[model samples]
Target: MSLLFRRPTLTRLLLLKNIKQNQRSTICSKPPKEKIGPVQSTFALCVFAVTLLAPAGWIMHHIPEYRRQGQNTST
Candidate 1:
C-alpha cells in the first residue's frame, strides 16, 4: 500500500498546476454599458423570486397529500 501511494504522479501534479493557472478574476469596476431602469429591474427581481419559490411553494402546498399517501403505503 505504501509503495503504491508513495509519491504524487506526474499527471496529478500537472493537473494541480494547470488548475491554479485556469482560474479567472470576476472583479469588475466598470460602469454599466446599458443601465437598467427601475421597472425592468423590479420585473427581473420578481421573476427571479417566483422562479425560485414556486416549486417550494407547490411542495409545501401538497404536504398533507404526501403524508396521506405515505400512511396508505405503510398499511
Candidate 2:
C-alpha cells in the first residue's frame, strides 16, 4: 500500500533530522580543558596495571592447562 511506503520514508527523514541536530549540538560544545595531576595520574596508572595484570595472574595461577599447552608449543 502507499501508506506503508510513505511511512518508512517519513521515519527515515525524522531520524536523519534528529541525528543532524545532535551532531550540530556536539560540534558547538566546547570540550573540557583539564590536566591530570601527578598523584591522580599515578593512581590511574596503578588501577590500569592491576586491571590489566590481575586477570592474567589469576589465569596463570588457576589454569594449568594453559601452561602445559605453552610448554608443549615451546618444546
Candidate 3:
C-alpha cells in the first residue's frame, strides 16, 4: 500500500530533522568534570583502593608464574 511506503519515508524525515536539531543545541554540552574537593577525592581514592585490592592481590600471586615464563623464554 502507498501508506506503508510513505510512513517509513515520513518517519525517516522526522528522525533526520530531530538529529539535526539536536546537533545544533548547545544544551547537549557535557558536564564539566572537576575535583569535587579534597574530602570527596580522598573518599573516592579509598573506595578505589579497596576495589583494586583483590584484583591486585591476585596479580601479585601470579607474579612467580609470569616471571618463570619470562625467564624460560629468555634463556
Give the whole-model CA lDDT for all candidates, comma-separated. 0.92, 0.87, 0.88
Give the Cα-based TM-score of candidate 3 against the true structure: 0.36
Over 4 Å off, model 1: 1-29
After superposition on all CA atoms, what RMSD does each candidate show versus the true structure? 5.9, 6.9, 8.3
Model 1, backbone clash pairs (residues 3+ apart or across chains), number: 0
- Which 10-residue window in model 3 sums to the lowest lDDT? 1-10
What is candidate 2's lDDT per residue for 1-75, written digit by digit as tens?
A: 677565567888999999999988877566668877899989999999999999999987978888788899998
Clashing pairs in 1: none
TM-score, per-candidate, Cα-based? 0.59, 0.43, 0.36
Candidate 2, residue 43: the lDDT equals 97
Candidate 3 backbone collisions, by pair: none
**Per-residue lDDT of candidate 1, residues 17-60 (tens digit):** 88777754445678999999999999999999999999999999
* Superposed Cα deviation of residue 37, candidate 1 (Å): 0.5
- Better TM-score candidate (1, 3): 1
Ranking by lDDT: 1, 3, 2
Compare candidates 1 and 2 on lDDT and give the better one: 1
Q: What global local distance difference test value does model 3 have?
A: 0.88
Cα lDDT tens digits, model 3, 1-75, are: 677665567888999999999889856577778748899999999999989897899999999999999999999
